[model samples]
Target: MILTLLDRLNRRRAWLRWGLLAAGLLVAFGLPWTLYPPVATDIVCWGLFAVAFDLLLGHAGLLSFGHAAFWGTSAYGTGLIAIHSGVPFYVAVLGGTAAAAMLALPIGYLAVRRSGIYFAMITLAFAQMVYFVTNQWRDVTGGENGLQGIPRTLPGFDLSNSFVFYYAALPVVLLGLLAAWRIVHSPFGRVLAAARENPARVRALGYPADHYKLVIFVISAFLAGLAGGLYAVNHGFASLQEVYWTTSGKVAMMTILGGIGTLWGSLVGAAAIVRLEDWLATAGFEATGLVTGVIFIAVVLIFRRGIWGTITHLLRARAVAPVPQIEPHLEHDHDELQPTPTN
Candidate 1:
């Protein structure tokens, strides 16, 4: 009977997962109609970035304060390739992502040797160094002026139109999300989760926990680079702002606010943040930082586990909630054998 009840709950969970996925896709399809094209595209980029960051921080139990290094590197790499090679923008995006992964390999190798704040500091230090180099390399990177005139062409097709570009990017974003989901649900992902919960136990079981951390760090960089490349393509420029420390901070904040390890929560957090920022800007709010901080605090306080996290927690609780304990009198069935007691 207990086994039967568990099976029913599992099936219910599967259906709920599919239903949520369908609902998300439906809402995403209608987003552009409700918001500006460029704004919609920004949301998609940030959403992908958040998911990538969460994979490493939330799942692998690594906190990085220099993710913007990968993001900026990809932006620069993508722009340079598009400017010179004149290839399809997606090709340039891939090239840029490769560059980010290569950079991550050495950095992650060193950083993964440490944990907690040490790990974060190591990544941050390397990222700052990269930022300095990029800033000084004015001719190649365009430095303060930024890398401009990057084309958004797809052979004979023009993606110069913001509306058209949003549609083009939407599918790619969905594919990235799907890939992240698969990564989380696979055997490898199970190992990652175990490692996160108890690295010592995972190591004792003969798993190379350190190697996994390095690998996921690189993987996270690759995915983040994809987001950065697309962002550059959308704007037709790569700027210093991409490599700034605050860029990393913002993504980190969004991931935490959404719920540390929940991948879809990143999307919810990203949407909340991006929309809030956009609204603040449009309303002529000069003190954007203060207002955004207040909003973030408000959301965090209200949705303790994060907006999506709290919602899912409730749903998960409801799905497998414990059966109520019945009083001894009610425990007896109409036809069940019961001991006769003398009053």
Candidate 2:
């Protein structure tokens, strides 16, 4: 009976998850109509970027301070391809994503050898190298001015229209999010989580934790690249700002704010950060970063589990809470209780 009850509970949980996912997707699909197309696009792009980062920091237990390298590289790659070649947008995006993954291969190999802060510093150093190269290569990258006038031509779609472009981009972003979700729930994802909890134990089991880390790093970079490419196409521009260290920091903040390891939390975090920035900009708030920092501190202090994490924690707590026991005397007649005492 216990096993059957547990099985039924698991099935209910699975259904609930699927229902939530479908509802969320529906909301995402309808967002462009309700919100500005540009704003909606930003949410999707940044959300995907945050999810990618979470895959590394939340799942793999690796903090990389240089993800902007992949993000920026893919943006540039996609922009160059779109501007110089007659290829479709999807092809350019794929090419850019592949380029980022390739770049991650050697970087991850080296960075995986280190752990903790050392790993972060190594990644940051490499990212700085990438930034310097892009900045100095003025002829190719257009230097500070960056690349502009990138073509938005996609077959059978009017990408020139913001609404159309947003719809076009939404599916791709959803796929990326779904992929990340699958990664987090899969056997490999379980191994990655295990590696995060105890690298030595994973290594002792002959899993080669470093290899897992490297693979996850590459995968995360590829996803970041995909987001960047989509962003570039959406904006019709690619610039050094995308690859800057600040960009990396912003995405990191998103992951943290969204409750880290929870994949959907990344989207919530992205939306929160992006909307807050937009509102601040419109309100002529020059101290936006200061305000954002204060909010981050508050979140860390008051809700250490983060927004989504806190919500999930509360739900779980309620689910497992013990029921209050009633006194037997209250349920039985007073006379019956007296007779029982006599017996």
Candidate 3:
């Protein structure tokens, strides 16, 4: 009976996970009906971006403050290809992801040397350097004026329609999520997780810990770049703002708020942050900074496990706990019955 109950629970948990995934996809594809399609697209892009950062920060246990470099680089790369070279939208995005990964190689080499706060500072400095170059390089980056008039979608597709763009963005986000999930669950990912928990132990195991860190850094950058490219295509432009240190900080916050180690938590965090920002904008609240800061602190204090992480932990605990499956068998033998049988 205990085994039977356990099997039923395992099936239920599996079904629940699948159901949640289906619901998420459905909402991504259908949400444009109620909300402006662009908004949903933006949320998806940012969510993916945050998740990418979470890979390094949460899984790899490296906190970088310069992830905006990849984000802005991809946005600009794809936007330029779409606007100037007339490359296919998908191709442009691919180019952007590649560019970000290539850029991460050199940066990750040096940044991975340090750990904790110093590592973050190094990334921040590098990101600021990128921001400065973009702001100064008028010919390619258009200076502070930013890139404009990036063509959206393919020539045949009606990109202006929010629903169309939402659909277009959906697949990209899904692919990015899949890649991140694969990396986190793989054997190499296990090593990285070990490195995060104990770098010395990972190194003692004969793994070149720095190499693993670099690989994940590059992967994270690539995913982040993909999201940025999507953002550029969806928005029809890329800007200096993408490279700003604050952008990196924002992604960090999203990761933390969503539950750093939890993959989908980043998405939940991004949605909450974006929606809050939108509501504040609609309400003409000029003090959004104060409001957001307060919420960030509150969430950290109240939901340390993060919104998604906390809920997931609770569900997992419930799923794993044993359930009462059978009542005890009660036996009663009467002497009168025995005498009747003897007769």
Which candidate should be chosen as best, given lDDT against the real structure?
1
lDDT of 1 by residue, 26-66 (tens): 87888889999888898999899999999999999999999
| Cα-based TM-score, every candidate | 0.92, 0.91, 0.90
List the global CA lDDT of all models: 0.90, 0.89, 0.89
lDDT of 2 at 91: 90
- Candidate 1 TM-score, true structure as reference: 0.92
Per-residue lDDT of 254 in model 1: 85
How far residue 269's Cα lies from its native spot in candidate 1, in Å, is: 0.7
Worst 10 residues of 3 by lDDT: 334-343
Which run of 10 residues does model 2 get worst, by summed lDDT?
A: 320-329
Residue lDDT tens for model 2, 94-161: 88999999999999999999988999999999999999999999988899999888788787777898
lDDT of 3 by residue, 1-343 (tens): 6778778887998899899999988877777786767888888999999999999999999999999999999999998888877877888999988999999999999999999999999999999999999899899889888999888757777778768878877898899999999999999999999898888988899999999999999999999999999999888889898999878988888889999899899998988887788789889999886897898899999999888888998888876765564454535646556665431
Better of 2 and 3 by TM-score: 2
Off by over 4 Å in 1: 323-343
